[model samples]
Target: MAVSPAAAADTDRAGTGDQRPRSRRSGRRRTALAFWAFTGPFLAGLAVFTVVPVAWSAYLSFFDATNTVTPLSEDFVGFGNYTRMLQDQAFLDSLVTFSVFAAFIVPLTFACSLGLALLLDRVRFARAFFRSVFFLPFACSYVVASLVWKMSIFNGVRYGLANAVLDLFGVDDVAWLFNPDPPWYWLVIVSLRLWIQCGFYMILFIAALQQIPAHLYEAAYVDGAKPGRQTFWHITLPQLRATSVAVVMLILIAAYQAFDEFVNLIGNQAYARPPLVYLYYTALGTQQDLGRGSAGALILALIIAIVTLLQGRLLGFGNKEGR
Candidate 1:
């Protein structure tokens, strides 16, 4: 076989070219498989836990789905559950209570968090220690904290911390949770929330504050701005618009989901019932009306979405241009 050098080179080139494409295809296949392997479980969990439940709840909301979860069993009273919950006195009162709590907690938390963050930002010593100390309460659960507040701090006895303090000024023991005449329970709940929330948000604000360029403050001072109020209003606050909006949105959603503390503190009392507590008693309490509960849940979800979107619109949340 008298093969020319040129023919041998062409055959070699063809063989190399074939192997290259096959190797490339093998690498691509491996990469695709690895990605799926990593993400498949997460996707499955999302479908099972989040998607299926929401769809099922939506389906159940439209039916008289009482006592059983089997789908569409001849008790399909269309929109009956939704309308009934809308007219429910307890549900309506719960909405008002949520509004009141949000009104107080959101601004108060924002202020307290910002204040703590600013103080910590200015500190050059023991900053981490103070931050941890402030953040420690957040690790405690709502139920436990509510019990502490109810039984120890504001227990309406002379031995209680709050009442002990009041006793110093010749005041009698105050019924913090029991007395609805003055609604002193708000102080306990608000303070507990502040203790839990401020540290976390304070950490957030501190991060945001650290990101602010020092030159901005320097330039403000150069432009006849004072250090205390003037610099904060002009340079500090405007720079923190994104963080502020996010904190407000989070606080709003948390307020809407208020349940654990209220339930543990008051035990299904109608005096200051949040929507979740009210819905819980309706769905799982003595009545056990699942249909109305599902409807209420959807309505609450709608309200939350609407309010969040409105905040985003009004405050330019997620708007990069404004930022």
Candidate 2:
């Protein structure tokens, strides 16, 4: 028997409904495949270069994976490597030095960078030129910069630029690199760091400063807010708080990871080495003990993680909308 027109229409509607879901599923599958196709190589590279090494390092930390011709032939020592750190006086001293270094450099960089950003924000002339001039140092290699500081600017001789300036004040040339009595080395290290890194953070702050709404400043001005410190405190700082948090965190991480310059300047000297430099010397330095090196790295990672978490908690780092 022939189906009625209404029944035929219902049948066609049922077919169309079934086909819609199937088509949707097929489209979703294609999109997923395309995503994987594009991202697969990057994910593979990340796994090989980053994720695998990190995991292997953690594994090695628990073992006596040192002094063996073959890494795989190493025996397990459990937490022996970790406990070694307690007895390692030089490593302990390095941690102290790094903490002192971070304490000084982080705040100084933040303040100087923010100050530069503020100054540049107000400059109607030569703004870009000044920004480039400041930031150009950041592009220079840290090793080269440190060497310049050691060889040219802060050279222990009387002809060094810093020593010449001191001479103008009748002070004798100071051994900035080798003098550990009053820790004159810190001046070289800290000044070099400020000159190289402050510009990068300044650029970040500048970007954040530019992002602040102009209308808010205009509104503040109409309400008798001056363009000086008043406007800066009320309008600029609060707006830059998030960027400031990020800059501070970056500075902390970078400070903790310091090695190249320290090694290049301090060499094999036992004085004023940071944790990373210490770790390098421990693992590969005359002894070649990979186990202890790996262990120190993991411990440093833990310390950094703890400190970062504490900072995020204290500063409410990730909170965007007010609670």
Candidate 3:
């Protein structure tokens, strides 16, 4: 339709204004799509694999769903599993064993890793070589390492490496894994854990150690703080405090979850079973009780959470510096 010049100009301007908003809307839509494209897969997998499983486990803990074919047919038992767990003597004993192992391994690994890191940090000759050497054991599979400790080192025979070393000292072969008098199985268990994990923690500490400011050490030296234990105490340790806290937390969590080594080395024996091992036996080993297993798992999780919170409170984790 042929219109006046002024009307045509106004019409053109109105059309341009509408087009601007449409273009902006299209741009925003594309941005939203791109965001989903990048993050959708990961979020979906997390929900399906982790979130769903945890939620289902929580739900399962309240039911008597053991040996059932389907959830619909399962019986609901409210707090029955929790009450039963308290009365299970073997379960209680497993907690005690876990506690003792934690007491030994946590401190031992922390000290050994820190010491190795301190030494390695100062090494100028073949620094990478030394790091790789120590870290090599960590790269090996836990099952493999456990097997090596069980069969090769502490075989409880005259030909075992441990016995060979003892022979050098004129000591007879000892049944390290079987002897219950002093609980010598601990030697095999503890050494295997330390050897496999110490290097990884050493790497962590080494990285933390490297991040410390050289000027701090220099200032310490200038203040008549000689290169001694005092410098390490005042400067190095203070700088590595955060890393140390994290390492200790990891050690505690790992200790509580100690199952692979215990199972591989000692089987399902009462002497070395941790909470997870005991739960495993309860759930699938002969009993086939998934409900009780889930309950025990949740309990263990609670223990871990409480211990973590206590450690965090004591160490002031997540606190801002100076606060």
Candidate 4:
């Protein structure tokens, strides 16, 4: 039997209401899919370019591979490369050099940066100008800084600014770079690193210092706390805990990777070189041993990872206690 006109209109309206929800659901799904489709290429490129290459390098570290026309043709040597690295005296020496460098640089950088940040935090006039001046060294290329230090500052003779000033004081010219003595060369390298990095960490500390509530300092003052005592026991040190942890880790990592300055300033002809420079000289200059180079790189990577993990754990523990 044919439906009445009123009944047919009710059925059409019900059907339209049900279909509307389905259409809206489909539109939402399509929009989400389109968003992913747009982002998929970038994600894929990062995995391909960065992640895959690092994985491949780890794989290559186990093999006796050279930079050849065909890398795949290289022989697999298991832990042979690693074993050789363990016995290498030059590798041992480099490890010691890098360790000493880290020991000196990390603490010195933190102390200097913290001091500068505190001083700058109190400054009222031309704060921006002072900050820019301090951070200017970080803006210069490492190679450029190295060259400038080599030629102008540490030039051994009276031609160098340092020696000229010393000469005026009746002091002799110093062998800043070429010295194979106990601490002079190492001191110079450490000083250069401190100068370059202190500015960057100072900026970071300034930012962290800014995040701290001014009311806290005011409260301390209201409580009859002196500036030096309050900063030591309450304000400066506690607020800087997290920033200190980060700066320590960064300085440690950079100290281990000290290469550009050492290479440019002292060159391969130096009596002492850092681990990275030593590895480069071994792989390309003297030994032509890609396997050993890969092994050294892997070892350095492991050391960095272990140190970072330990620092993170310690920092996490401290944060929990602070909370």
TM-score of each: 0.89, 0.88, 0.87, 0.82
What is the TM-score ranking, best to worst? 1, 2, 3, 4
Positional deviation of residue 108's Cα in model 1 after best superposition, in angstroms = 0.4
1-323 in candidate 1: lDDT tens per residue? 14443454455555556567677555555655655677668779989998898888888888888787765668898999999999988899999999999999999999999999999998899988999998888898888899899899989888999999999999988999878889998898899889887899999999999999999888888887889998888888988989898899988888888898888888788788999998898878787788888899999989989988898899888866235
Better of 3 and 4 by lDDT: 3
Please give, for residues 262-287, the per-residue lDDT of candidate 3 as tens digits. 88888788878899899998888779
Score residue 197 of candidate 3 by CA lDDT.
Answer: 94
- Candidate that scores best on lDDT: 1
Per-residue error at 154 for model 4, in Å? 0.6
Which of the predicted structures, 1 or 2, would earn the higher TM-score when compared with the native? 1
Clashing pairs in 3: none
2 or 3, greater by lDDT: 3
At residue 98, give the lDDT of candidate 1. 92
Cand. 1 Cα-lDDT: 0.86
The top-ranked prediction according to TM-score is 1
Where model 1 places Cα greater than 4 Å from the true spot, the runs are 1-31
Predict model 3's lDDT versus the native: 0.85
Candidate 3: residue 119 Cα off by (Å): 0.4
